[model samples]
Target chain A: MSTLRRNPLRALGGARQTPGFGDAGRVVPASGITSLLTGITSAVMAFLAVFALALSLSSGQLAQRWSATLSQSATLRISAPPSEIGAQTAAVLEILRTTPGITSTRVLDQDEQRALLEPWFGPDLPIESLALPRLIEIIESAGGFDAVGLRLRLASEAPGAVLDDHTRWRRPLVQAAASLRALAWFSVALIGVMMAAMITLAAGFSLAANAPVIRVLRLVGARDAFIARAFTRRFAIRALIGAALGTGLGMLAFAILPVAGESGFLTGLGFHGAGWLTPLAIPVLAALIAWAATRTAAMRVLRRES
Target chain B: MIRLANVAHDYGGRALLTGIDLHIAPGAFHFLTGPSGAGKSTLLKLCYGELRPVQGEIELFGQSLRGMSRDALADMRRRIGVIHQDCQFLDHLTLAENVALPFVATGRPVPQTDLRELLAWVGLAGQAESLPPTLSGGERQRAALARAVIMSPEVVLADEPTGNVDAEMSQRLLSLLVELNRMGTAVMIATHDLALIRNAKAQVSARVLRIQDRTLQSAGADL
Candidate 1:
């Protein structure tokens, strides 16, 4: 009973028989050493798969966020002499207010201007001393204002006013994020392939080592499916156990990574809310790979023996 | 039932068995005696569907062996039990488990009470929990016999079953075979032991056939 509890499939009802009458032998011997090694390999591969899944999903989210934030806004830079700077700024504001899809507009205050320059220059640098261009922050409505139309209007109204819609930088940033997301997904797929290959190799090794066992089984009238099931079930269960452990460890690692609080690449590399469910698929996938690998190897060996 | 009509089998380049016409009927007990390397074991293998004849038709349970699929052969094996001289056994399994192997192979659960009775009948009730590697040659032979008849097969084919056991143990094993025969199971035994065949002829009406010069013939008035 205790043995069955530890491995429910070990002394299954199918193998048990009326005592002393028929041979109720275990069709295949328990391959502890090979199973352990395969399990460990599955675990490591699953861990990597989990990380790849997280990275791809998070990067995808990052791409969407960047596209949304950048797509909804534009900026107007007025580079006129001090005398005309005030007049050009007023003209640009009046034109933006009249333009369609311009939800809201605001002129940068002295403090806002200084904060924008703080990254490049010292915080204490006098903002009024240099003849910096006056900047206007524009927020677009859900029906975003047209960049080309706005630029044409500004060209005629205020020659010094330059409309910068940020598409030049936004497109590349979003593309890079999307590419990273795709690369992560590709990595996950590659990991799955490698896991299958490793499992197939391990299963082949096990079959070769148990040649005598197979011979005995065939002599006793055991079929190929029966022998294959013994191996496939053992390997599949091992892969499932190992992958579960690996995924847990992987999730733990992701949890401990430095959070990208405001906006950064690594910040988007972690699972959020229901996204945590994604890594759970890793164990199931590993088990399936193990089943396929072991079954193929067992059947091939049986065929060649026949 | 198994039948071979003008069957001939050959190795890569040499003819092993030729011009063989044989039929094994239900509840029939047959003993195939031949010298070493005279196709006695090969003939036994052919009877069990383990080997195909190179030259004629072989039928098992009314189906031709040439046209049977692998699955069909497996199902056919369920009805025919075979024992080898070397007594192949999964060493990792207990003696009881080894006996119940045929049931496992057929995807059926071994009935524990019946299995216990079978082990006791083979005089190995106490050795049920022992491993195969620990068993003596005689014990292994008895265990193999127990396994062979576990499925209650229609026919049992044994090759040199008593080759490795002592004279006393051989007689005990022969008694078990004779008992199976009385219960309506067809039995075929291929052996080189003339003394054992003489002993068996006294207990059961067994027809003794011998193979020599690549031909099968009845050993008239031998027993």
Candidate 2:
């Protein structure tokens, strides 16, 4: 009844039709199991993704903190005969004071040393009785001291003084933290892949279940794009809702977690400040993944059937 | 309009319909009559682009069915409405929605007044909100008829449209098809009911083509 003159080739190739309210999503009947499966899979995957993101970011922060703290300071351990220990310590202290980048120096008192060793040696141990080496702590300025030059100076002035710049141990720790962060991000990627796979399977099942509905639609002159859009829109919405729930729960879990104080690594594994905004993108990403997965599945199935 | 030239279709590696030349022009009325499994449904499917012939070319609206893309075929189908013998409907949607499906499929706005009038004409005004499963056999057939012509298609191909309905309902459905043909919409109904054919011959000049031994033959006017 429409008087509009249309191109025959364009009509054959399928003209783009504006989607009406009826054409939007109600064409396919919503199945209970497939809907629930898609929602639950997206929610669970997004929840795990949030955890992985937190782990990756926290490990990155831990690596940076360790690198900064370890690079700024060095320790000098003076081990010699009890008669020469005091002279060697004095010599090392003099060399450290004249160093260009040395900001301050503090020698650990007996009580402080005892407290450091209390975890292993017990609080009741007599610190004076044992022939303990004298330890000198060196704090460096913003420009770090040259370890090689300082080591050469200490070896000449005080033979018993060994400069421990913390490189050998710090390097490995920082490397391990960096590796952990990479592994966490890899896990997030894996979770996204798994979500896509699950959504694809669910879409396939839904399409098969709605085979009769599809036949009816096709008989009524519904284009493949219209059918695919209906399915993709439904799946994307379900994923968005599910991911929103999962992300909210993840944020709440982090909120109630024990605050990171002087406590070690496990306690610091959470979002900090503006980093809290990162998880909000998860739902959007999940929706996109669902849309792509469902669209692919629908087109494949429709093409095969065609 | 549909034209089949030297079309031959096979089923399970055997010819079901062969050496067929048929044309359903604009405003033409056709009745395909044959025994069960005589390829009446198959021929209807071929006309609608549902099945391709193994030996000949079919043209719908002057465009060759061969080499047409699926989307192209789908778009071409919008000009030709088909009602299956089983009266397929989306079980979740109401009867009104099913009848207006062509509009929905093409993303066109449903003409509410026309939909209401069509339902009324089909004697289904009260059953607008009823589900397909709840409708009686006669009502389902009438609903299918309404759905088929709702798009104001150039042609309507129906397979055994009145197969499960009563004599009165069959007559009523036939009159609707006749009315549509009078309004310049080509119609083709595939059925085995000679009485319905006789009933239709009185009201409209129709061509009755019978499929016998894998070929089409024009029936005599003895009835």
Candidate 3:
């Protein structure tokens, strides 16, 4: 026993021997139903957790991308008469170029404007014939151009220029993405809680079914810790194996998903780079939860018997 | 050593044994005899810290049994071995493993040679690898006895240790208990077999206590 204690992993791996048993870990009879229930439950929970993790990470990436892309740029549209549109666009470009925080600016040509309106209208729409607004795209520096200051300057210089900073739509889009990320994470937490509950119930049933074992152990001068260790160790290993299988299947499913570039937001829901390593911790966490749940249940039942 | 002072126990909310006093000294040999449902097993349980007396102070190894923590009681129990009538065992474990349980429970390495010799002494060296379910009644009783003495406990409590065995096997088990007593381990056997008790007296000086009328009394020198 002292030799086994010196190398605890050996004990866990069933290397420790009893005189005639040849193995020290088979004190508790293996119950096929309990093992199956624990394994299936952990696998299912871990699989769902993987999806939730992917969704959360993807949503967060989407939110940050939207916020960064929209926050650094603004559009100035000169909606004057066709004759004055050129003059107003030129005036807005001059003001933006003179601005300290504005890095670069471009006026959307006829073809660009036509492409921008292609979704709304047909591809053959005559952009040069319509009395459309002239658009100026402004890219800001790291110290972004102040929206209020730029709007004032545009009003004085190009009265027909309406500076659309994209703030009105960007804020809501970022907020929606952030909320999605939060919801996904909450789902992951819910999965963990549900897994814990299921493992606890399983542990409880196992303890009930092995009441005779408990009685015999207690009668033989075995401490509660010894008995509880037997149970906790078994349940923890079961959960670990189950969660690993589930996580592997989930990752495989993710691998088969369409790439982010091919599809859209739904397809973008997966780990990127080092994020793939995140799900590996799920099995470990599941094992910890199982250990805790089984220990608590075992101690409770043993205490009642005492 | 176990000392019960004015111990009174109730079973199912009714008085079963009252004002029972017993002192199991080192190297002492005692036989507890009573009719069925006469509280002999209850007395043995109380002696081994399996049950708490409703009214009394029970002392084991000079420590009071009252208010003892479960772990402390378990530690105390390691010094006292008990053999139940049915010979409880982990059915999944082999006879040898069952015998070495005390060592395993205490986290001590099982003395392989000692375990083998002990089994051989109980005439079960050949059945070491057999599961408990495969053992006969006599084999189970002998296996239980081997388990009880595995730790070389200071006292041995046997609750009808020979209840299911033949006369030859019963004498065999009684002789084994006598041998353990000769080694200075206190022995208490709870049984209703007068012939076994008479047999035990010829081999060793033993005191006979009978539970009669819910009280313990020393038997007359009839045997």
Candidate 4:
């Protein structure tokens, strides 16, 4: 007992130890390689986590852009006999000039009108070829004029004129974009939950596979902490690897996105300045998730063993 | 070094050992002999804190076993070396890694030269890199002895260390235990082989104890 007291670490390094593998002078530690893999997994998971975060951030941006840009624009158009167009245009300008909080109004020049119609009616066409409707752009102050009230008055005062607040046109577009952004965020949340579940399962299976090894370690007096360290380190590395690969591929795909607003469907979908740095955070977040998962699994298993 | 008084153990409502009393003095070499299922192994388990006695007192190094925290028990275990009948090993690991497991568990590193010498002493110098599954029964027993002594523990408790080995291998393993005894380490061997026990008596005085009807007695003692 006195001798054992002097060498109180016997159980941890006691006999009934392994007798095969490595050289006499340099025996390798069993968990060394496994732990390295865990570290790799941690890095990969962190990489993927950045992308998850990116999706969430972009979703919020999309929602805000929809609400902000869609809330404030209106257009007015006048269709009349060729002789009465000037009269209608003058009457519209006079009405706009007297309205409350009417900031500024511009009558699109013939060139601007031609450019607007250029898509369907080819360039260089004679201006008098068809009964062209006169288009006017309006700007309003912070507390702008009431759109509904103005349209009602316009309908009565100028039968050949119509006021469009652009609300109906922009509503569906913004709603669709907002919904798409929400879906992206939902996908990101699902990925995170999946990553956690996958990592947990992987760690648990690995621990089960190494049951014999764990038993021997315990017989030799290993503590729960020591055993947990090996597995936690190992699983974390695995997650890191998977996440990094996923995040890398995600970035590559994002890079090919058409310029924002270049097309209606793809408009503002890509990241803005400094947003590139946003995705870079995925790997770190992935690593954190891996760390949490492996640590949880390892501790759970070790606690039961001890 | 260890004491068990009126110790009783039960498994699944069946009694394995009942009313057993034994005391092992410090720095003593002793042998426990009994038939299979007579609880020799169970007694060792009780002594090592693996299984608690249902009724009785167990004291290790003069401390009561009851109410001892796991950490405290683990601390106590660190001082004693125990050898199992099967000589369990982490098969995936090499011999050296296996031997160094205790060091690894305790969060310490063994010196390379000392490890080499120990392996050489166990006659497994060439098999250090081999896996546990590839080792012969005798070699594994010797390796176990080496690991037990690695920490230079004061007490060594072995359960049927020679059960799987041939006569020749048994002598070699016994010799290692005797040597450890000569070095002032308390040794306890649980075996029913009288020939081996008689042989062990040749060089040094050893007290023999026996278990009968779940009770320990010193009738066959030969010093």
TM-score of each candidate's B chain against the true B chain? 0.98, 0.98, 0.98, 0.96
A1-306, model 4: which lDDT tens digit per residue? Answer: 332343354445554333322332222134555545554544444445555555556656766676566555567899999999899889888888888867888888888888888898799778767788998988877677888777777777776888876778767866776676677667666666776776787678777878876666666666666666676555555555656676776677678755665444345454567887776656556666767886788778866663
Better of 2 and 3 by DockQ: 3
Off by over 4 Å in 3: A1-22, A75-102, A105-137, A142-165, A259-263
Instruction: Please give, for residues A127-240, the per-residue lDDT of candidate 1 as tens digits.
Output: 889899998999999889888888888899899998888888889989998999999999999999998899999899889988988877777777888888878888899999
Of 2 and 4, the candidate ranking higher by TM-score: 2
TM-score to true structure, per model: 0.82, 0.80, 0.84, 0.71
- Which is the winner by lDDT between candidate 2 and candidate 4? 2
Model 4 chain B: ten consecutive residues of lowest lDDT: B214-223
User: Which candidate has the top score in TM-score?
Assistant: 3
Better of 1 and 4 by TM-score: 1
Between candidates 1 and 3, name the one with more favorable lDDT. Answer: 3
Ranking by DockQ: 1, 3, 2, 4
Q: Judging by DockQ against the true structure, name the best candidate.
A: 1
Q: Which candidate do you rate higher for DockQ, 3 or 4?
A: 3
lDDT of 2 at B109: 89
lDDT of each: 0.87, 0.89, 0.89, 0.74
What's the C-alpha lDDT at position A62 in model 3?
A: 91
Q: Which 10 consecutive positions of candidate 3 chain B have the poorest summed lDDT?
A: B125-134
Candidate 1: share of reference interface contacts reproduced = 0.43
Interface RMSD of each: 4.7, 7.5, 4.9, 7.3
